[model samples]
Target: MGRSGSCLCEAITYQIPESSLMEAVCHCKNCQKQAGSAFSTLAGIKKSDFSLTGKPKLFVDKATDSGASVERYFCENCGSPIYSALPSQPDVIYLKTGTLDDTSDFNPSIHVWAATKQNWVEIDSNMPQLQKQS
Candidate 1:
């Protein structure tokens, strides 16, 4: 069986056929604004193993500090973020872990954009962190 997730209103549903290639947390400014939280939990999956059932609206984010465009996809009905696609990495889609039906297995092995992370947010020292994506 695959992993499944849906938007808040259940308007948008998705499935990933296998385990994620990577699990990570992003503390970038634009991700914070879009998630309305300190950070975004992400699961990176291969594009070939992903499937979506509903039409999600896309916002091309061009103001990223990384200087790479990010396509943020969300549910129009509930305004819940679903996933983000990177222009530089077309083979992967970073799913918003909060949307997953069960996140017990979600543990980020890495953290990115640590330089912009909120001071109040304490990151696990055991996990690798990057000041910026290299």
Candidate 2:
């Protein structure tokens, strides 16, 4: 069976195929500001694995490193970020893990953009941390 997730208000829903790649936690400034938290947790899944149930507002932001644009989709009603897609990497969509019904089941295998990680936040020491997305 596929994994499912939805926005805080359940206004937007999506699914990821069972074989999708592992989850990741991003400490990039864009992610932090967007999530209003220390980091953003994302599950990488092929575009084919995802489907939207409701209309979401899209905010396109340019990545500092690649200068590529990333389209972030969220529910306008609740301001909950549902997913993000990179224009340069069209095949994958990063689903916001916090929107998942079973968020406890999500484990981040890697933490990226850690150079900007907040000093108050402590991450798992065993997990790999890279300066940028790897």
Candidate 3:
């Protein structure tokens, strides 16, 4: 089935095209901070496959490691993070997986930024954990 998601307030909704790419979870410190959790789950989709129904406020944060600029889009009213786009990688968009209607099927093929992960967070032993995005 095709994937669809929306912001916390439901003001912003999006649909991933059938040909969209897979999803992944990022364990980077910046992702953790932005998500206010152990990690951030993102559905990587083509730029054209993703569309926003509402206007979201954008925040630009510089990556600590790569020094690349990451754009975080969130709901202005609810302050719920919606998605992210990196300057270094312009072809793809990382949609916040939490916003998806069905998260049961979503899985992370690899974990990035595992070095900065929280001590209490336990990751799957089978998945490849990289110190940083490779």
Candidate 4:
């Protein structure tokens, strides 16, 4: 079996195979705004291993610090973000870890967009940080 998750209202559900490419924290302004938090916890899962049920509304965000369009998918019923997709990496989707059924195992190996990270949120020195998306 794989890992499972759903939106706050259970309007959208998804399953990702037990393995993921990476786990990280995003401090990009857009991600922070979308998550309504200081940062967004993300898991990079391959598209082929991801399965979804229910229709999520898609918002094409054009105004971004990265100057790239981001396809933001969320549950319309509760406005809970589901995942984000980038055109540059069509085979991978950045999953919003907050929606996961169990997040105890989630550990971010890196922090991206540290340039805009909120000063109040101190990052662990042991974790690698990037000023921008790699």
Candidate 5:
């Protein structure tokens, strides 16, 4: 069975593979701002394994620290973030796992852009964290 998730208003829904290539937390400032939280929970899934229902508007972010354009897709009606993809890498799509129907299995093994992580948020000492996504 496919994994399911939806936007805040349910205006947009999605189905992903039973698992993802990677699960990570992004502490980039832009991601934090977009998520309205400390960081963004991301699940990288192959483009071929991802499917969507309803129309999600796209915002192409060009001013990224990594110099890569990020195509952010979201529900226009409810303004809930859905996913993001890099123009340079079209084969992979990063879904906002916060929208997942079941998050009990959402285990993030890595943290990226930790340099910008909020000081108040303490990460587990055992997890691998990077100052940036290099």
Candidate 6:
């Protein structure tokens, strides 16, 4: 079975197969700015396994802590973020899990960019954390 999700306005919708490649929480400053929050919940999905409807506007973010460009996609209608893609990882897209219809199962296995995490955010001691993107 596949999972389904949509943008806030339902203008952009997407579907992914049974499971994702990985799930993580990104605490990078750029991610926080784009998400307008403390962190971004992401699910790594293969491009071939994902399907989408509607067009999303893309913003090429060049100012990243990793020194790599990130392609941020969002709904033009409601301005809801859809996903992000990295040039180095052409086959993978980091889906914004918040857009998922069912996010109850989003268990982030790791936290990236912990060095820049918000001062008020506390992470589990057992969950793997990276000071920077690994």
- Per-prediction TM-score: 0.97, 0.91, 0.91, 0.97, 0.97, 0.98
Off by over 4 Å in 3: 18-20
In order, what lDDT does every prediction score? 0.93, 0.85, 0.83, 0.93, 0.92, 0.94
| Model 3 pairs in collision | none
Q: Compose the digit string of candidate 5's lDDT tens values, residues 22-132.
A: 999999988987888999999999999999999999999888888888899989999889999987788999999999999888989999999999999998999999998
lDDT of 2 by residue, 69-121 (tens): 77999899999998888877888899888988777678788999998999998
Candidate 3: residue 28 Cα off by (Å): 1.3
Show the lowest summed lDDT stretch of 10 residues, model 4.
Answer: 11-20
- Clashing pairs for model 6 are none
Candidate number with the higher lDDT (2 or 4): 4
Q: Residue 69 of candidate 2: its Cα lDDT?
A: 76
Which candidate ranks first by TM-score, i.e. highest?
6
Instruction: Predict model 2's lDDT versus the native.
Output: 0.85
Error at 103, model 3, angstroms: 0.8
Q: Which 10-residue span in candidate 5 carries the lowest summed lDDT?
A: 61-70
Clashes of 6: 0
Per-residue lDDT of model 6, residues 94-129, tens digit only? 999999999988889999999999999999999999
lDDT of 3 by residue, 45-114 (tens): 8887777699989999875565777899999988789999977778889888898888787777878888
Q: What is the lDDT of candidate 6?
A: 0.94
lDDT of 3 at 3: 77
Which ranges in model 1 have alpha carbons more than 4 Å from their true place?
Answer: none
CA shift of 63, model 3, Å: 4.9
